[model samples]
Target: MSVVARTVGLVTANLLAPAPGGRLDLEGATRAGAGVPLQIGFDEIGVPLSEVTFVVVDLETTGGSPTQCEITEIGAVKVRGGEVLGEFQTLVDPGGPVPPMITVLTGITDAMLVGAPRIGEVLPAFLEFAGFGPTTVLVAHNARFDVGFLRAAASRLEMPWPSPAVVDTVALARRTVTRDEAPNNKLGTLAALFGATTSPDHRALHDARATVDVLHGLLGRLAPLGATHLEDLATLGDPVPHKRRRKATLADSLPTGPGVYQFLGPGGEVLYVGKAVNLRRRVRSYFTAAEKRKRIGEMVDLTQEVRPIPCATELEAAVRELRLIAELDPPYNRRSRKPHRRPWIRLTDEPFPRLSIVRSVPAGRSAEAIGPFSSRAAAQSALEALEEAFTVRRCSQRLPVVPSAEARACALAEMGRCGAPCTGAQSLEDYAEVAASVRAGLTSAAGPVVAALRARIGTLAGQQRYEEAAAERDRLRAYLVAARRTQRLRPLWRSPQLVAARRTEDGGWEVVLVRYGRLAGTSTVPRGVNPMPTIDALVATGEEVPAPSTVLGASGTEEAELIADWIEHPATRLVQHEEGDEPLAWPVDGAAKYPLPPTA
Candidate 1:
């Protein structure tokens, strides 16, 4: 058995060794030395298959169902570098008579198991022998059965089950071996086909040994197809179309750094845009079996090139990806695709200045806008809340400064819902006061809005109108959410220039420069180095932004919000600016005084 193991080890070593130029070839086996070391200098995507300790496990059970059945015997062969490391075999007393059928199949009768250790004892020994964690790969012919029985036994014994990475030889055989080579992926059939020295005969140890050979055979077949790492084993049978797999070369040139990657079609059209902490790894994964998205597979089919735009930090990569997705409108990239479509609640440019839902706030009137609400419906709900609080006109019609008698009141005015400013019932001076209140509610002072909504909710609740009260509560909640967002974001957007820094994992400094709430530049200072010079250089070379024309600043509202979130992150430290510049601070009491209405 020892000599046979050495021969199998030699065969496996030759089978898995990379050919000259770091490619595996079935016909190039003669070029490999007897004990060739595993290839070096490859990026560590996952544990190398040659270095992984695999425990080929098999179990004899009293019944088919793990929940109802008891494990009779356990057998596992631990192997690494194609050599047998150790073996674990033990019989477990089920504490019940084995059924005639199970006894006949496994040949483990009650007489043979009289003094065998019970599952509580056997399970601990098996776990200790199998080892734990990433270095260990658990292999079984049909892993579900063996692993299920083990986990059940552990549960029954109240033992901790270390769930290790598993490889099912049945699945692997189906992936690597063809129907012509083997009629079906069964233990007996595969053992014969792979020429295993031990033949499975309904016993645990014999079947586990046969499975070790089957596992090696399957890996030998998968090696030529580029499934050499432990991570590759998980997606062994992935039906990644050849066209998409071939295009993986596009990622070969990308750097392993934080960046935005654009998948370009044949005509140079951007197919998709994405951000990743490691450009090379992320883009390369699209071609591997692990990338199972049908849409992404289709995108890869169309992708003739992958273009990388490396950034200094992850935040920069995220911002650039957002901007590119919005700019290119890549068909395959979802989310953040339409920055222009984000809805905003704006006071229309008119004498009445009714609340309106607009896509983009007109250049100079962003202060009159309260939101880049998540959706048009949310903006509408907030508008209703503002209208409920303040008697500003709900009409969409633009009215002149001095209304003609022909301009009759709308139905809202007739119901006394509006102040009837259009019909001249309310004087211009009085209407100005109403507009001022609405503006204050949207921006600086939301206390009045919250108080009014709260009072309305109380009155409705007093009438036992719970449903209406709930509706008002939702409206107020929406208003408060939008108001709070605006209050936090407005200050950041209004700042002429702001600098912030955060400590990196390596004690380095990740510094960013913001101009009007848009990320202008970023730099990293190495560990144990002076960050001041780098920060000063970053500020001096930062993109020059003009005075913001809108409350959203020079960028889209989403971009401004992204910047605000970064600035407010707990790790971020604001660098104080020279005197006379407005301090980078949100109003302490802004909208904080306006508590949201309780759910009814």
Candidate 2:
């Protein structure tokens, strides 16, 4: 039919219509990727019904929340160039308990999907079979629900959708039909009106077929003239496709001590090396976010790999981080030019409180200070450990004093923490000497208690006390990790400052959280705005922390405010780290895996 003729026929029929117009009936919404609203058969925009290719998809979901919900049944049909492609029908394994309502709607029980490979298996096979590829287009009654599933699936698998273009047939039906024609334009009524003799089975494939027929009839009566290409067709309702992604699994990175970590990629490339107080947990989150995921997945798919070198302390981790970067030359390490130093505790006032890595001497000396650890997180952890084990005071030296009669020294002095410069227990000169000794302890052997424990370990081993020796070893490891945690405090954001924490697919990054910028408490993001890691090599270890400093480069001042609001929300929780969790073992150099022959 010519375009002019179709228009004339539509208008003429409108004028001579007995009632108002054909009642446009619509079925369920799209259950896959980025689904749109349920568009009526006759779209609000008046797409004229005749100009576009259409497909109908019916899905029976195990439940809602596409991630948890699996489709029990999927029925789809394509109509383009006025012909239906092969009917798409399949029963998917939900891999979990199926809901009663879903079974009732679909008539597909758990027994049917039980032995089925699971939605993961079914989705890939079905899409491949359904001609979802570069050139394929799709249409559904309601696009949103259907599209959401597709998105979730794709992300879970770490692959981009094969096809993005799709149309909602329900929209066209609504635009062409009048509401007065029927109380509602559900599938059954529309099928009867279109002269399609099929009975409504509520089965996926059956409904899809009925939709195709009705759409075919509409096309026959409405195909626009000279519509030579797919793009030429006017979109009735916007096409909604499924968007897929994996969930994040971070948390457990920030710590009180210092340590080192490696950012690995496919084929074992060292993406970067970093140091943190909490090493194990900080490494896992890189892979979980959306942005980092694509790269990690791609790298893993091409070359699967992972690698991590442990350290005893944050100071050690900082030093090790620089060494690894120098040796590994990971392509992703851009800010490696700066040298790392364990922060030095410097006194601030005349009595000088400990200063660490005094990045710069504050002009004349407003404060005492120490180092510039490879990262601030590491430095803080180290300081904390020292304070705990050495019994050094961590509070600022400039404490408030009571009246002379009341200034009998705080309880800290009584508890041996005050160093007693107040009540003539020690002279200022003598206190300085003691403080100097405390600072010197950083390089000295641990105090008498540690020495005594070491001697015990040696004595137990000499007496063949293997069990005692082993216990001592475990204790030492714990102490090392604890010490590391206390000394380092700057490499990571304060917990809950990171966003979506998850491991990457390729196992390159254990977890990757993003912070759009400083104002956004890092943890509030839950899922940061960075690219997520890939699927194949998954090793999600830690939660993602935002790059608070990155706030500088963003466009507007409001960006900071926007981020601040998100962080302050009562729902935000700090990311926590667990000990001994490790990144997966992987190769440094790219290597190929080959199928093995039969064993000899």
Candidate 3:
């Protein structure tokens, strides 16, 4: 009937026995037992559970479903370090008759809520009492029931729900408390098993209080397994397999900063590589149920350790991830692993030059190339378009200093597809001029080749040659995109050392240093950190990669292209540079006429 009477009755029944003076001392026994083998939960190297504020909540409704029923009462206890900080409790009119079964179960009668406030009146005060902080953890026994109702109420009331980290005591108990300790993971049973000071009586506040005790008890059980942080508690509620849980320790030492991470498999092979704004969080996510990809799950199952490489900014992390994936060629990476293998559209350097598809950039050749196309088919398509527009020589043999009169011209020359310089049908100077026009078209956007191809497509379409028109259109689109990309990359490729910066989300700056279009170094200036010193330090430490003796290789060509794309991003502004910066001269007319290839 009363709290003290219940306590005395428990003592009389020997559940809580009297101490030395023959007077009941529940506080003494609690204090004595609370210190006994306190299982420390997850290692709190980043943010400990003790530092997190929790709002343990419970709700009583007219029925089980939030949509069908209505919340009759709400209760919450704000706690940190097992000490109560604040509380919120309210009764609300359900706007209808209280069901007899519900009233019988919760003892809440419509008469008692006659003039009580409704949900709209109660939710604001409850949210205010819960407070607002990123560190806040919302706790509830069978959390979905409470949180779901609250969310529904917020939605119906047009109120904003600040989604805080949620911990379900029911899920926690299932993971932490053995069945032997509690027959069923129910609030009343768990409360009784854990020696909760207050027993659950189906009233919201009383149930919430009992759930709070259960939460502490379950957390104590979890400490032995090193599940102590607020994030740890939030993550464990899911049905993550035990083996995966064990691998979570791999992320324990990872720094909480922007970086790239690799999951290493047996024999130290890199299984996967990824970049993240927070190294620790991202690595931890791989071990959690949040990672639902079956391939990633298998990779995680075989992972032996997590390797983190800290970066100065998200941009640095991204570039490093791309470069590492290219270098290591991890089997799990789906893209950017083997850049050298991608096809390139090369303009052969010869008296009668022609467009050709090549694997490597021809190590010593000085010919202009416009690719790194994903496949030879794509490069071939672009070459066909260039040939159709320029009619340059297409024979793939070394021509003699003086052409022989007996040398036969190919059918392409008779069909007017090629200039037939092989047989001297076209003069060497004339063929050279055509090749030069093709080179200019391959290296710049909206050049003669593009203009010719576009005009040809228009003429074909105007004549109702729909199929031919579409084919020409596709070819023109591909050539223009490749050419524009090459134009954008030329400046970076020619510069000996290029430094640039963009403002970061945290009111900071991200500085990127490039050499020959490849990422050489990157650093950041945090919001309040004096940017000049950080910039100077970054420049000092950066490897001033000299102007590469040879052309930019295909090994990191995709990375170079990626950097160019970032530099061209509408949001990015060049903040600093070793050499003067020039605006990327993209065609205002080309993209409108033809669709360009999407950047990687």
Candidate 4:
């Protein structure tokens, strides 16, 4: 027999006999504010069933609908470890006479409630007796009806309702008790099956007593099926598949720390990579009903082993997870798969520089690179926007310092779209001036380019070329987005190195070192300890980063942007910064000031 069954069987076996130590308390208790319900944290392993206090409650109401009905009486029994601790029972005034149908069903007459206290007076006492909070679990048969009435009463009375964790014995009985064991999950049927001392009637106190016994019986049946914790009981209805749950042992070896975890398939291939604030708890959650994602379930079923990489802080774990996903290209990781492969638009180093889409920027010409746009399509749109505003040549051929007289001009030159430098129609000096304007539009100042695009959109709209005007608007928006991002990241790339720190919740310190926008090192200082020595040591031992060759700095734009965001977080404090010739600061109202073409 299960432990709960063995302990509580005697109480149920003797039907109609009062349980030992089951005493009803008529006096009311008082507690402070209606406390918030406690949520089960990711790091919480389990709350043992034996340690949980359950308050089996039942309410007598004037009508079936909570909105129309009023609570007439409150009855509750607090029990722990198959033993009743106390009971609360009281008739409430309900502010009106009992309905004829309610009186016929419950035998509660208006005369019987002559001088009863109101719900406002009775609810606070009942909540206090129930010990409302994490340690207590409220239980009832057809719990929705009873809890709904109580919630409605509280709402009507303008009283705070502490939303305690609730367990519906009806739901539990359906999951645990066989049809042969009980004809139905009703309070009376369950109470009779369990041989409860008190029989359930329409009255509040009797039904609450019966539900306490029923709750114990259901818990006993669930115990053998491994429902030994409050967390397990909460998910009893939607139990995890046994096959998947058997693999929960994989997390047994993982430490309770912030880190990255990889689920490996049979062939040692990484199936999924994820970061967690608590490695063990988060990994174990995959085997519980809490993890409801279908793709994740498939990945879990295929997982043969769990690999943990512990980190000192959440940010470090996040960075490591991103890097691992990029490196391994895990099949189950949908994000950061190609973190370093984002595209950038670059102006070539020829005598006549023309915009070209390139993944990596050329050395010493970081100023000529415009973006790390989300996709090639977005970069193309931005490129087209700049092309529309400038007279630079659009041809792909390499133009000489002096163009040959035999060189043929493309149709773009005939359409007046290009300067036609290849045909010597436009001189190098003239093209140079245009290239400088394009370069200026790409960086430092984008107002002229934005104005040109807006003007083109307005002219197109005036001509009733609305489709073309809408296309111009899209291109202008894409260009402004990329320009804003580039302007935001440029200052971080220009800085030689930066040291910053943020105070952790535990009163410790998380210090980070960045060299040219790349996270070079990180360390933590325990609470009450001097952080200066640790910060100095971290800075000295940090990786040496050479001067960045492109606008992307010493790392991919994504990584640089991540580091820059971390430095700008409100909690972060700058300690030291080695600025280049120019001060490391973003332009005041730079590309952000440029307006996009209006939709209409």
Candidate 5:
């Protein structure tokens, strides 16, 4: 045998050969120091790397398949901040004969494991030594193999598996060390490249020790890529090298709070806008090897600097992001850049009021609009449905409030589809009553107008007029959605100011302070803390927003839309104030006439 092979074989035998206490002393010979392990699945964005714990592990099995093969040996080194805290090593009888080829490769024969414990006996002890906590991460040369075996064993034994975050050193090396530095990404090859304290010779403990070294080496490389937290390492997959990473320093100044961020190109031209709960972590993520989008990489390359604007809440950040995207018209933004361009169905303020589709709500107009529809077709469909229920005027004439006698009723009047108010056939009082019914239907889906439309649709469907029924259904859906949107916003429009709170995932409360229809401020009522004080503070800090009438016309600003969305959230509950400060009234029985179909 070669000198190197002989030396490695002697070392492996010495370590594997049980001690007087029937435990391996390999850890005592190699472990640097005892480390303090952190909790499992630890996820904090700015947590220092020194506080993170990694359980580097390796396993030797009979074959590749976990079910078909059996694990012969398991080894792991518990590490925290570069210190070796503990070790787990064991040999297991496969409950079957060892393959000759495997024995030759790993030098672990059936005779060596004859009196050893089975996997069922060894796994529990290994898991206990390795621990399962939030801050703990499992590392392996090729993690999939080791993790798969453990998972299979857990399933077979029906043991509750604590699935800690796993990191694959092979993947880490492929991104950290170039092929020129370490030709093939095998465990031994990387071990030698990183100058691991122990050489891997197929024995589990030695291989695991070597893997720990490689992990530390790769972590050093990850520092320049902005991976400084425990959670960062879990997502640090193979990244296509980004040229913009050189400008990664630009994101260093971003705050670790909820906010909107802008990527600016040369001459300070905005290239892209994005929102994140943690500005620093999100902007830093682009510099890491994990960002895979080619477009994002290209944008990052063009980006010369990053600008972060902190907000009071994630919802505020989302609204600010939309506003910034619209204001800058950044080339990278693909949506919500034109919140004002949505269609609205307006009721013209003439003697014979008629529905008119408009992109913007005309200022100083006496017309009331119900919209912000996705398209004109949807608005027109809703108008047609309203006409079916209320036969008002459809003409485009500047008639007197007392109906002009010179007006001519079009084909609609002859077909009994219109009240013929244009020719004075329909009196002003009667027409006003029809207009009131249309307004009620437009504001609430449960109103009489929608009920009439629903009944009409059902009658058509029963008669096998399938196309007519479908058309009516489409009209009803459009009207319902517009009404729902208006219903959510109308409360803010009616109330000068509204304070509300929604339960958060962390059992806290998210308080939103709004003026008119805009979000003025927001704050968090942390768990076990008094929410009233926080809510009061948030209200005191609210910015003065334009009155709802002037600010949110037909289609409101993005911020208004955002606040409306918040008010409609099912978990949101309004805090009781004086009776005089009551917010906009909603349908007490609920808008139940036309139930929305399941989304496609």
Candidate 6:
């Protein structure tokens, strides 16, 4: 039975549960703020590595898994740009007897734990001591384990959780070290290899300090790789070199929920994406596979990483999957069949600027742009067509203006294509009106273009210009095809998603993942057995497929940026669409979404 299932019965009727022991102390020393962590060495993300705060945390718990365990000890040390500022260590009295095995493992005895303040009494003070300011970030080793406990303890006490963001040093090691660097991830093993320093004892504070040292060592190595934020360090770990994960063991105790999962190769390439309502049960399914070697050869050969995000509901999980797929464009996911690839019609910024074909200009920085086409060739053809039909300039180089009297107001002016500015045939208002029409033509699709073409066709037929009218008809069809082939409107998972995976009892496993869409806070899912959609979908929106730059060398950097954006989306204060029952949405401004895939 899950430890969490057993502890549910421990809550008291009063909102406040009893303190674990008599009040530990009337705490006084002013606590520092928890600041956000940054890849201090890299400058692109703009978060100063020095100014950002890092809290190294370790928790002693009664058992494994926060859902099943109770926290007995919490230790932390705050550091800024590698400088230790202050620290917090406290003991929480677990109301139950300490299990013998746990006592031996942690050396935290019942005697040492007794008479200590319960998590409820000691938490607020510790949170205050952690010193969270607008941007403090936490650091831990295997952070999710500690983070989960902190979350649970805070929920039980009804106190505001002090820190929401964290950095894991283990993840840093995985990113920076060679795949063959270490066979094991035990703290002492990594510290010894990396020349990281920590107290000899395995106490909470010492462990936290060790993690910090190890993280510093990792940063010292990866800074040259150009990591400017913790996200870079956290995600840049080298993928496992071998295929397929080690078989799930009986030791793993899984949780049931909705989430997305990924299989990565040792080189850190995403091999596959899956989801499950119940994390443990879903993941277990893979382990029990009779044809595991054949059915999952790609996964086994390619996978070095496993990532999961938990969701409150199945729908949210699916949504998150779609978002990730869209954003990350993981090579394994479905490829977009858009007719044009970032094919856009650009209105040039220079004088005598005319409509032209271009592939992708920056977003929110347009020179009067419209439509992302299915192919660059399509955009080029469209531009050619428009240039012929309207004598808009096509050359990128500046052209000498002809004397208006001799040129007879150019072809467009004669046909009313423009306001004849060269010949001074119209007022500024007329010129403005013509400019608006040009923009409309660029953005308008087949239906409207056809309607305009039809009228023009009649006018041309009267003038006995049937050839021009027929050409106009063809242009209308092209626009319609482009629009139908490329325009995609789907729901957005604007919020950060959390995916949790653990070992399953059945040999195969399931995972529980959460999707906090852009607007809703969080929704908890019912325990059920089912596979989730895909992450490519959740990360699919508003992304540009990447190209290799001499600087970036093209191994999913574009995709990495997209994933990072999804992970680090700023807080969503208002829902674009209204919905109710969001579990954790209350700030006047939205809370920053988490971007780190692992809870390091």
Best by TM-score: 4
Q: Give the TM-score of candidate 2.
A: 0.31
Worst 10 residues of 4 by lDDT: 17-26
- Mark the regions of model 2 whose C-alpha exceeds 4 Å error after superposition: 1-55, 133-135, 221-600
How well is each residue in 46-89 modelled by candidate 6, as lDDT tens digits?
23455666667887888886656788877787776556777677
Kindly report the root-mean-square deviation of model 2 from the true structure over all alpha carbons: 21.7
Best by lDDT: 4
lDDT of 5 by residue, 272-362 (tens): 9999988877786676554678888888888888988998789989878877877889988887667677787777766667777877665
Which is superior by lDDT, 2 or 5? 5
Model 6 global lDDT (CA atoms, 0 to 1): 0.49
User: lDDT by residue for model 3 over 1-600, one digit each (tens)?
Assistant: 110101111111111111000011111111111322112122322445666677788899999887778998888888775567766777888899999998999999989888888888888888888885655667888876787788778878988877655677777777767878878988999999989878999899889888888877777776545354444444564566777766777887888888999999989999999998777766776665556788888899999988899987776788888988877989988985666677778777666676778776643342367766766777777888888777877778878757888999889888998777777788888877777776666654355666677788789989999788888777777777666655556556666566677778778877787766777778777887777777677768887665554444322666777787678677666656544233335445433345563332
- Estimate every model's Cα lDDT from 0 to 1: 0.75, 0.44, 0.70, 0.76, 0.69, 0.49
**lDDT accuracy of residue 311 in candidate 1:** 95
Minimum summed lDDT over a 10-residue window in model 5 is located at 14-23
lDDT of 1 at 414: 77
The RMSD of every model to the true structure, in order and in angstroms, is 8.1, 21.7, 9.7, 7.4, 8.7, 23.8
TM-score each candidate: 0.78, 0.31, 0.78, 0.83, 0.80, 0.37
Error of 5 at 24 (Å): 31
User: Clash number for every model?
Assistant: 0, 151, 6, 0, 9, 104
Per-residue lDDT of 500 in model 5: 87
Model 1: residues with Cα > 4 Å off, grouped in runs: 1-51, 60-73, 80-86, 89-122, 176-179, 201-206, 222-257, 284-294, 336-343, 348-366, 374-381, 394-414, 420-428, 450-481, 526-530, 577-600
